[model samples]
Target: MKPTEQIESTLDHVNMYSTPSDLKITDIRFTDIYGAPMHCSLMKIYTNSELVGFGEVRDAASKTYALMVKDRILGENPCNIDKIFRRIKQFGWHGRQSGGVCGIEVALWDIAGKAYGIPVYQMLGGKFRDKIRMYCDTDIDPHLSGVEAGQRVKQRLEKGYTLVKFDLGIGLLADVEGALCAPLGFLDQMKAYPPEVLFHSRATDEASRALRNKVYDLHNIAHPFTGIRITEKGLDYLEQYAAEVRSAVGYHVPLAIDHIGHIGVEDCIKLAQRLDKYTFAWLEDLVPWQYTDQYVHISRACQTPICTGEDIYLKENFLPLLQSRGVSVIHPDILTCGGILECKKIGDLAQDYEVAMAIHMAESPIACMAAVHTAAATENFLALEFHSEDVPWWSDLVCGLPHPIVQQGYIAVPDTPGLGIKALNDDVIAEHIHPGIPGQWEATEAWNNEWSHDRLWS
Candidate 1:
């Protein structure tokens, strides 16, 4: 070949971005954004090269979860994703506790994709579909009647969501007489505090923390053990609500139900059977996810599909649910289920059991793109949950994606490398910083030297 042609060929093989082999972790930082419906902590893993990868802790989780492990990964190559994940996975547990290890794992994939100049899905294997179907989660005002709730959900259908979900349970029956039959003070306790304060919020003060802890004690009681039961009056009220919703949206659209409150297994079965006439997409989290036997009983007793696992941490934990066919659909939030690769593994495992997979995403745009990549790669994938469709600035948090990211009930998977995010919208992010913990990607220098023995075995 000619000298000029040889020079051009050598340049073609060069990556102008960064030297992938030499990339090392330099620092980690985070910024918290509140009221994109829930508080979310966004993290960035910096490397020696100019590349930075974005990740998000699960909604309502603390960034301290990620920071505590910074020293374990300092100076390690970000491209060694699985090795780093194995090194750090021992720190993660179920639910929001897994947020740190999972978020960091996502950042590693983002870095790996940028280094290889390919999309995350391509690295996973390849795309199964170019666009992912989205299921809108509509949480209307609790004061609204069932008819009013139906009208609210109908608005989402008009906005182009083919699949939808709504909250329906004993919580809605708090005001109605003879609707619920729990212990003497249990009913009063639920009525005294709003569900947000009782379940969602991170306590800011001593009094609030005590109140939250008290509520948590009551709320954490297992379903069968809670002594909470729905009365026939409650069943009638809930049934009527479902009828109104089904009538408003018509039977054509796929409608799902969630947050049925902490009622017992018998109450769960009763409610599921009562709502069977409405033909819901699924009865989600009817009982705690750990009670596989209860789930099996509920599934066997009802026509509506049973779904759970949004708070489950890893693939191994999901096996019993899948193996027993406890639920028809396995819904896993990528942020809670050990990040992109682990979510894909869960989907693959579910596929082996012949159950479908739907992702449960409630975090920021960073995690959304991580889910998008995973959904595109999984063969048994179903729709993904979009919790912030009503948040105007939700789409403004990230760049390099289409405006109004969810177009007519589906998100077009991006071909761009590294979760398809060019950069975060600093201005938009700054406007929504958490009021209690205000900052924008401040240096986490304290976490740099937090060393300890993390090994699980002798």
Candidate 2:
């Protein structure tokens, strides 16, 4: 389609924003999914009309992620969203879709939006909200008391974040031994052990139930829309944990739960059914996207909203879910779901059904910025998750940005052209560089053992 042809699909596209300027990919950046901090790179895209756009590329921790990125986006037209993704997928065949191809595709759209001199949402369909409401996770230190968690909420409000969520299902079922048994370092261990062994080693019900109450107590004091991210252990004792939390906090605050890599849709439905009395924000990732029909059924049955798609790649991946109306909200991780442009499209589709959107974010500030921009443009955005609360150094990654994207718990839309945030490359390099992973600007040797057995498992 020509630049002026007015092409529109559920797919990612750059519609005219602020008079049509010829758009081209002028730059790229990337982020690493699994390691400390994050990794990213900037690339430049050029167009026949002499317009240039900047793009970003990122990946979760994988051996050949950087090489995989190069394989996909080196010469592709950053403006062509679908074509770029197709190219990335071809190179990403072996890896499936965790981060490599997905990250590069994201940066390309960021570049496209920048090239067009518009916020990504404007290209998607323009935005509905001036500021996107955000919910920060509640304070959870093995050391902190419920009062301390409540104090943190006061502090969070002072910092400007309006909403809060926390790990609610920690130690559940203290009466039952080994009730909560989440694998330690499941990210690294999952690479070594099969799923069954990992499950066997995880927490038991009693312990899981105990920890969950601790988290629930913290949730009890959290303000309304105080969200909860439940671990797999928590989900295991769904009936017990949900009942406890609802009773402890009362129904005034909205309850929410994330799958956290545990419990399929069946379990999600069961949990929702068990807690039907409380007003829930949503049931996140009841199952993976492949179980669309199951998700639909769960949504139909549960009083709680059904949400999924944190790891899904783009709008196309989410359309069937939306069309089925299985989910009440579409949860798109700005990094995983093809970045800002794709996320905006996902939100737009959700808007068609009057379904809301809640962004799933857990990366560094870079990904958060992309999310804020996209969320600013998305009308149906219910809330965006800021996963940086525990990490003090997260926001420093983008210290030079024009204004603080987040204030008083709401993120103001960036008025600048493109993604409207600059990468602190020098700081990024100083903090994130590791041996063989890409020295400075180049991809490094294959990463075989980046993760060691160090951090405690979940």
Candidate 3:
């Protein structure tokens, strides 16, 4: 068969009205892939044809759109990917229609991959490699001393993680109550030119210097790649901290940092330029993603890689950054960037600009495995971030894997089918969920509302 013909044949005939009359939409379930919620809808297409497919609505509100799409997909052939996406978008009038449709499209693809006996990556194009390099977070408890933090880094390296990220944001140690920005603190902090700089115990320059060295020393232990995450803090010390880190690690090791806690891109560029001596790996999130032009300016000003995108939710968010060549690396949080399929799309887009890709992760193994598969399939993937290195039982959450997920500083991608990791560890879920927060999303009617075509184009 010809390639185009094969592609067309791969999709079974799809019609909105054809149905065996036995199947019905049975259940809907969702998992947070990157802080945003994605869903899986199980449709019993026949008395015996129990075909389960997955879908997503980019965020919580998307569930409402999913509800709408479900009404349309009731008896239709689930094999028509393009038709389904077009219909969903057509009916979904609100702008950002792509998000909801893209998500459901993902689940459809998952179902299609399973139905056709192939991985989603194979259907997209083909796999590039078998394993992905990972950047593991060095987890630290509140108020941990430099010595204590160093121990955490050692443990991650010993476990075979090649790269590590540490948090240095002043907000981590700031006394919110006493902060001038208290109550509406983040806003006030943003207004302050040189934000207040404070550590867990308010360490002085000497103490901060000593502590920085202790943490830096861990870089050369078993593996040398290391990075740090600092909140937007006193700009005065930005250069000093960069110098301190460089002096401690020498020139061979790379030092990177993140600007969480609402810092502006201009300020981030200033800080990055100040820290030029250290040859920092990347200065992250100088400004929120909406400011693409600012990101471009920051990238131009600093030789250090300008990387952002963790907060970016999909391909559209990545295009502005890519088209401008704003950053050398594109960081997409697997959970936020529409899980595996969406993130890979972002990575592939970044690869076009010769930009490296890294992930921002904060979830469990379910999302990690999805990320691994996507990262495995892409050509320009740099590393996947593991944020649970400090959680003692983090690895025990998932079961029945062919090998340990992370090995010798990298994660071995699973060649198996359908996300390749089981989500059935009850004990692990119970142990990890925040005590006050409940698990299993409670259905909220708040998201449902009548839609008027404001954002949508005809």
lDDT (C-alpha) at residue 163 in model 3: 64
TM-score versus the correct structure, for each prediction? 0.96, 0.66, 0.67
Q: TM-score winner among the candidates?
A: 1
User: Which scores better on lDDT, 1 or 3?
Assistant: 1
Worst 10 residues of 2 by lDDT: 219-228
Task: For residue 112, give model 3's deviation from the true position in Å.
Answer: 2.8
Tens digits of per-residue lDDT for model 1, 1-458 = 99999988866644447788899999999999888779899999999988999998989888888998899999999999999999998888898999999999999999888887779999999999999999999987767888889899999989899999999998788888899898888778766764566435555889988888777776677778878889999999999988988888899999999989888898899889999888899989988899989889999998999999999999999999988889999999988899999999999999999999999998788999999999999999999999999899999999999998898989999988889998999999999988768779898898889977766779
Candidate order by lDDT, decreasing, is 1, 2, 3
Per-model clash counts, in order, read 0, 63, 10
Give the candidate order by descending TM-score. 1, 3, 2
Model 2 CA deviation exceeding 4 Å by range: 1-59, 63-66, 69-72, 75-77, 80-83, 89-98, 110-117, 138-158, 170-253, 264-267, 399-404, 432-438, 443-458
Clash pairs, candidate 3, are 33-335, 34-335, 34-336, 54-107, 160-409, 162-409, 168-229, 169-230, 169-231, 181-185
lDDT of each: 0.90, 0.56, 0.55
- Clash pairs, candidate 1, are none
Which structure is stronger by lDDT: 1 or 2? 1
